[model samples]
Target: MMYKMQFPKIVLIIIITSTLAVNEIRFYPVEAIPDIKKVPEEYPTIQAAINAASPGDTIIVTHGTYNENLLVNKSISIIGENPATTIIDGGQRGNAINVVSSGVVISGFTIQNGTGGLPYSGISVSGCNFVVINNTVLRENYYGLQLTNSNNSQIFNNVIMNNMYAGIYIHDRCSNNAFFENTIKNNIVGVWSSNSPSNVFYHNNFINNTNQLQAFPPMILDNGSEGNYWSDCIGSDIDLDGVGDAPFAGDRYPLMGMFVNFTLRYGSQIYFLSIICNSTISNFHFDRSNGKISFDVLGSKDTVGFCRMASPLTIIKNYTVYINDKVPIYIGNWTVSNYIYGYFLYLHESEPQRVTVMLDLPKNENPQSLFPILVATLLIVTALTIIILIKRKGKLDKNLS
Candidate 1:
């Protein structure tokens, strides 16, 4: 009888442990803030919507042509409905859009017709830590996008063409800004900077521009990966490694093609193959044509690692993982499912490492299946708790008799 009572209590502990282990594995999804205001629906003009919006609010503009300059003084997202159909015409005024506050995001619009000079721009950002992406800044009287005294900003995926001066101008000691994947074409100068140190440029295509780059002080043109592509880079890839031989003096690894892809696998289940370098990981996808999954990575001489904690649904008995076609040094114990698996890698000759997982499974484990298992374990724990309490009460009544 004593053994029978102890059996229920032991079962209760096991069920509780299983339930806790399953609940501990969590995936962090990037949260999207809902749009609080819409232009022409909530307010008549774009500037009016901005005036009525509070900080962290998103103001989405519909597809139409609006002839007015915008001044953003708060942290908000001014998103256009479509990049081609949505237009913000400055009408030869000072600037198309001037951002004076930080943490602003301007995307999906065609900003044009600015008449102002040096300090004035199509999109002038005096604020730090902003994002200007997925826009077309064309026919500017001065600079297309100017960054003055701004630090830690990102300017990416924009088509900056037909500008009279530089496509992008960084000045006044602006540091740690990243310019990537932009098409700076048909401008007088692609990128011109003065006194701006530690700015990074990568993967941009400078096509048909009169001058490529003009700098007063030296900047980090490349981060040891393939730098921006120049139309006049007369270099040739003899070994066909997708890196140029030597047309531009400063660009050590000039890309032979427009883009490059890498492969990564997460412990038995997740795989990101043919992915672009330095991208973000959002999902486990196999097809790159669908363009659904990516990872945020960097390539350099320093060592780096990729880590993921195994969920309770995954059984980690004997796992084989590869990084850059080489086996990784596994550093943690894997007796249970809630263990962390990590692969430490050292860069070899300025290239990103590839990671792959080798799994010989009868069927792939589903991460979603853990929920039902957790529910069943919770029910078992509740049932065993009642059994243990009844057994103790019977023993007490026998002692009293």
Candidate 2:
């Protein structure tokens, strides 16, 4: 449905923030929070909508090839209909989208073809704070995304590859920013953060870059126990924790394989989890009633197939990992802050297998749960039998009378 909306921002008490409780996080999904103003339908171009929008308004662009250099000076969200189909070509002139305002969000678009220099980028955020660039594809540009004097932003789940100079260039006091679950590959430099520090990177897959990183010290490359996956890293996971023992590409606790971010939604709510695995995952199912989460993972026989999951404690806890109803090797579990991070080794010998993580119900188990069902069935059968006997008795009495 297309909506040409200009609704004012609604102020709800108990506002959601990055520091909200994990349970409270799922209550407010990202899609439900913003007032949408459709592009092309409402306005001809994305830049036009930005020009007409209020500070907190959201501009949703439908799937089409839009060739323009957008300059976003106001705080708003520019979301595409679909990332694979939505194209924002810069035409090799300027940055595809230049964000100079704080609290800006650009998601779900294929932004490409910026001029080949540090000044031009697919998406450039300058002097902005609390910005988010996610679920977008940035390729064939000078720099996929560049941050200049930006602070406290979250960049995740982006495919940034095949750029000329660098996939991402961060400099000039970009602090407290996080880059996670992004696949940065096939560039001259994957990440060129020369003077930037105090930012943390985890769960990202940096693959096949000519120069993987040019980061300075005091920059965190891991989340203490688990870090990113480097394609050139030759370290081994001796303890089978899905993490490398030695440092690789400036990451201390490098991951074993690519980090996959799955948006496993339950009903109206969506749950996000990061999984590092060598196998292909599919059919993610979640049952909050039973506290059970299941998915399938398939891998080659030669590769060590494993799924390392990290999520909030409210999502999955006290759970036993199973593969095809059989138990996989319990690698380990680590509690990091409000999240529960776990690793399991499930090798299927070139076959596909289901991986199930069933949380132990606080009060109910299998036999006890079955007892209630059996009792309910018995009571219903008994009631039917009494009804039949009463009918028979009434019919006989009526006949005799």
Q: Per model, state how many residue pairs clash.
A: 8, 0
- The C-alpha TM-scores of every prediction are 0.62, 0.74
Q: Candidate 2's C-alpha lDDT? A: 0.82
Off by over 4 Å in 2: 1-35, 116-119, 264-271, 287-292, 329-341, 348-352, 361-401
Could you say which candidate leads in TM-score? 2
| Tens digits of lDDT, candidate 2, 9-108 | 1111122221232223445435635467998998999889999988889998999999999999988989998999999999998898889999999999
Instruction: Summarize candidate 1's per-residue lDDT along 1-401 as a digit string, tens digits.
Output: 67665876777677776766566766888876555798888899999999988888899899999998999999898999988888898877788888899988998888887665434578888856755555554556478888889988888778898887888888998989998778788989988999997898887777788998888776776667567677787666554334577647366666544433224343345432222222223333333232223222344455433333232223333345555566655423243334323223333335444545443332435766667677776777777776778789889978999
Model 1's lDDT to the true fold? Answer: 0.67
CA lDDT of every candidate:
0.67, 0.82
Q: How much does candidate 1 score in TM-score?
A: 0.62
